[model samples]
Target: MPKPASASALFSGPFALATLSESDGPAFPALVRPDEKVLDLRVALGDPALTVRGLLEQWPTVLTRLHELASTERESGESYRPLAQFRVHAPVEPRQVFQSGANYRQHVIDLHVAHRAPGDERPEQERRAEAAEIMDRRAAQDLPYVFLGLPSSITGPYDDVTLPEWAQQPDWELELAAVIGRPACRVPVEEALEYVAGYTIANDLTDRATVFRRDMPQIGTDWLRSKNAPGFTPLGPWIVPSDSVGDLDDLQLNLKLNGEVMQDESTKDMIFGVARMVSYISQGARLLPGDLVLTGSPAGNGMHWGRLLRDGDVMDASITGLGAQRTRCVAEAR
Candidate 1:
């Protein structure tokens, strides 16, 4: 099981939150400490029906109460349990997941140049320069490319991902996920951050082979079959409140596959920041509490290294303030 780091590095605030399941009971929300101890919010707040999404729906009020709860020392008779006794699941059950694609400048350029047409014989530097220019134009004028992802595809941060047999080239795209705190529609870019409750880490696993529809050249990408397999999205060790996180642009995103560093970049490389992506998505779809808007991954995906995921490979992904998540890959049975 993956454990959180020390208090000084793991979280910027008093505590973070997570969803956990006991041996014989259903999943419940809890306040997690860096010391590996957890206090059940349902029992502490005296609301058994309370959930992470429910808390987010009432974010403003609940956040204040949470601050108060976090300030004081644990009182006698309070039920605090060790984190290891339970299973940690995705922090929130989002009604919708908005995924931003090609939002990172270098990532887009790298992919475009790497997957050049077979017959096209352009010098490597020339191809890269052309791709970079296109990205610059898109960043200045074009709107962000956003798509939907199924909530059912989410799995625990430390769970084993079952790679489907049909997926020939499974790849990893670790991204920063913004958790929405309130209902937002047609929000402006300047005000989009206000609707974000917190932040978490998400690995958006994709099957490279299924990315584009071979049968229909004009139809473009097929994200559903490429990305929405069960356990494809491994999200959260916990959520750190938005206020606790520092400048979004300064956050460092790093991912290691089988103990080798695959991705090491800062959010500064993103063409469209979190605010713009959120604002753009809200213009079309209503973003509800617990909804996740995944900012696109930075450069250095599996494709960049010409190496894709295989059975038994483990991916450890993390962002600056948010905690880390580890997922081991397993092959599907015949």
Candidate 2:
């Protein structure tokens, strides 16, 4: 119950948070090392609390303690487990998940141009210019488009993603996710970063074919149908602290499908940055500690490749400083 230090100060330390499963058992929270090994956080921190949720709830009070313990264990190099020895779980089981949509400038333009009606064809430069203009105007307006995601969709970073039997064109959207540590409601953009607990990598899987409700296209995107499949959201390798992340705008989002680089972009291209997205979504609702805000995926989705996810395909997604996620795709059993 101490006054929360600025995110810049909190993240300046070396500690990060993560969850892991041992022997295929339940998940436990741990302090993820910057290089290798996962320190048992519950015991490392002297156990005033437990679970990833506990870490976030008391982050302000324990941030310094976390740094001290992690630094000692790391420097001492004692009782460490190799990163690959255990199963990495979703960084946290969030109660609410907020996802930004088409927040990447180029990603939106690609979708616009790629899906344009045949009769609306125009020169590539012309189309690009138009899209750029729209984005510029939108940025001036300062409006962000966001949607809800189900907590049930979250899974381990290295887990298997099951392509539901009904899904035709499942796609991958590699994104940077912000973990909210402090509760926020109606917080202004300037003060929003203070509430951020950390950052993580999230693959916002989508079912492209079901994106729009054909019966009610006017009603807009069907986020639930398009995004909330079980294990659809592959999150984490680690929740790298916000200050540790340096500049959110410069983080590189890279996703390789079967060794072929598909999505390569910087968060600089986001139409609405992390602070903006968090502030916008927290207008009326309280963003609780441990809540996740996914900052939308960059372009190069399956729709653009004309090659959606297939059973046995492998996806490896990574963001600068936040570690990587490798998920194997499998067909859902009947």
Candidate 3:
């Protein structure tokens, strides 16, 4: 029996095979070479030294071999190209994209602060109405405050993000994206995290007018228009397997707009952890491999800054182990 592959192995390059290209179609059990190039398993398997069958039959073994190769390179002082050399697309074509809202206490307070005037009358009726609004918003921002983005919107590493004309305040969110590894239905909270295959970085682009209004339905609801603007979700770089990143709740997340830090917070601040979220979402809907769950964003969004993204603005977002994604904002084509 061949040894299982390590996380680092799957990402190393120079594997005695040609690199895979996006035009080649679906890649199964592929390798990301150190030079940031993709190596198709079908092509690499042709190499006599690393004998393997199809992706499903040999995924574990392939990972192990790649791990060994990566380790050898590290010990021998062999340097390879950076991850930027390889173009990255979504690791899996997901069926659904779920997101949470107001999952942080500070975020909740911030919203209240942004909505109310200083020294405004806090009458009992108004307080009840606000409390009711908050409760409704909670459901609207539940564990998997879910929404759908057309698959056509998906882009890979270093892709340009176009800000739609109506998106006056396009904001950046540094979020931890969980990729489901297996089919899960009504999964218990204790076993929810087990269903995750890996994690990635997601920029939850928002049109403040839309999300805010949608949250306060009495004010108005334009969620579809607000949340589903074209090129809104810029995901990728690569997916890092769950095992490679230990302690899901302890990771630090950061967002840099232009060259300045905008949002800095830890996953520890999350009111609902990943396990609880997975379990809550899977109650009725089945979580298939490649389905993405974007845990909520922290404070310091552009709306909070009283600014909006202009053309040529650069945004970088990263989680501890998951790699960073750099994107530039461009004006939508007229």
Decreasing lDDT order of the candidates: 1, 2, 3
Best by lDDT: 1
- Candidate 1 residue-wise lDDT, 132-199, digit = tens: 99898888795899999999899989889999999999999999999999999999999999999999
Count clashes in each candidate, considering only residues at least 3 apart in sequence or on different chains. Answer: 0, 0, 8
Candidate 3, position 230, lDDT: 61
Per-residue alpha-carbon lDDT of candidate 3 for residues 254-292, written as tens digits (9 for 90 to 100): 888887888888888777888888898899788776678
Q: Candidate 2: worst 10 consecutive residues by lDDT? A: 1-10
Ranking by TM-score: 1, 2, 3
lDDT of 2 by residue, 130-185 (tens): 98899899899998888889999998877889999989889999999999999999
Give the worst 10-residue stretch by lDDT in candidate 3. Answer: 1-10
> How far is each candidate from the true structure, as Cα RMSD in Å?
1.6, 5.9, 7.7
Candidate 1, pairs of clashing residues: none
Alpha-carbon local distance difference test for all models: 0.89, 0.82, 0.63
